[model samples]
Target: MRLKVFEFDISNSVLINTQTQTQHHLTRTEAQVLEQLANHPNQVMSKGQLSCAGSQQAVMSESAVAKAIFTLRKYFGEPYIDLIETLPKKGYRLNISTPPPEWQQQLAQRKKLIILASCMMLIAAITLITAMHQYIWFKTAESPVRESRVVTLNNHQQIELIWLQSPKKSSQQVSNMEQKIITAFNLCPIVKWRDVYLAFSNDMQVLNISMQGYSSNGELLVRNIKTSDFSLQPNFISPNWLQEVSLCD
Candidate 1:
């Protein structure tokens, strides 16, 4: 009995037509390997040369390259080695025809999609970080401002009272006021007198006072004044109706 044989074109691209008559496509790397094999036909190309040809910096291991070759053979169904032969310790040569036009187009499309998706993800991450930073800045800008005051007595016995005005007015205005006060008195290191008394005037409503004194060693002594229980009389002097109580000895 004579066997029936079917003739099919193998040149174009690597394709696996199963016994069930189903066609499967190859990836670009696989196709490139097959193309290399087609070019070498009978000679074995080294793994290094093949990797370089594929624009890869590092050459794949021999076993890995062999596996790729095996996959290519399986994809073509029949032994593609008739056109391309794999030489041990050597590279593969082209023994098969070119891949089908449709396969090449599909591979190109897949690569393009991969590149586009990666770019989009990077852009999205950058935009999210920028928005978060802006939100943080706005929150800090909207928070209530903190107030501080300083008073200094010069060697000439002149009194200088310094206080932080509301920053909402103008930064330049506040800065200028502070500079003017500092220049007028030429006050030495402002010291918080411990024996000073604090009191609120009958006309005032709300007052918050914070005092920090530095020791000879540059250590800070901090005091938070809440209500008007302390006095600001002969020991400590300030122009403001509210005053900070001196807690130091």
Candidate 2:
């Protein structure tokens, strides 16, 4: 079974972060501990139980188990690390219950709030930039509407990646776009990409993505290269824009 702890997307032994669109390779011992804790969820699994979760022939010391857990926590960062709760003499558990009563409901609504916030921020920033420039003109492009993929060459350049949903689009088209996005992320700093944040409209058809770039004083540049098929209405599921999404407050 696969599991996600916060930003980390676990598919068998491989861990990927949907936000950064980057892969997180875990050590064998870390994988074992993560799987064991993820499998059990809210229930505490003793160090012995986690150590034996993988190869029965391979023995793991209690200290080794502790180290694995420590490393796993550090890798995933905050909030997520909080999910791994330690028990005195017992072991550890994934504490998804660490929240108010309606945490999942809050998660569902978070997408909309983020989209709204991003739009506002972008608009405000652009207005300020326009005031600074003597003149500005935007160009229109005519090309096959491909799903959004953002890559930046400098720290001062920000890019937007939008995934659209349309009746004319086949499921495969959406899949291909996502695969391309993932490939771009895999290319990393070499591809000129830095960071990522995920957001979606209230209807869930549109995705609002933010890619990190350069700061104004640091080398300002404004380029909104949108590649979206206007014929299609964006659907959150089709492009599976954030299909492998995992949340951490």
Off by over 4 Å in 2: 1-12, 54-58, 97-249
Give the runs in model 1 whose Cα sits over 4 Å from its true position.
1-103, 119-205, 215-219, 226-249
Tell me the tens digit of each residue's lDDT in model 1 across 79-129. Answer: 434444666665666543444599788999999999999999998988887
Best by lDDT: 2
Q: List the residue pairs that clash in candidate 2.
A: 155-213, 155-214, 156-214, 156-215, 157-214, 165-233, 165-234, 166-232, 205-234
Taken over the whole model, the C-alpha lDDT of each candidate is 0.48, 0.59
Query: What does the lDDT read for residue 121 in candidate 2?
Result: 99
At residue 68, candidate 1 shows an lDDT of 72
Q: TM-score of model 2 relative to the true fold?
A: 0.35
Collision count of model 2: 9
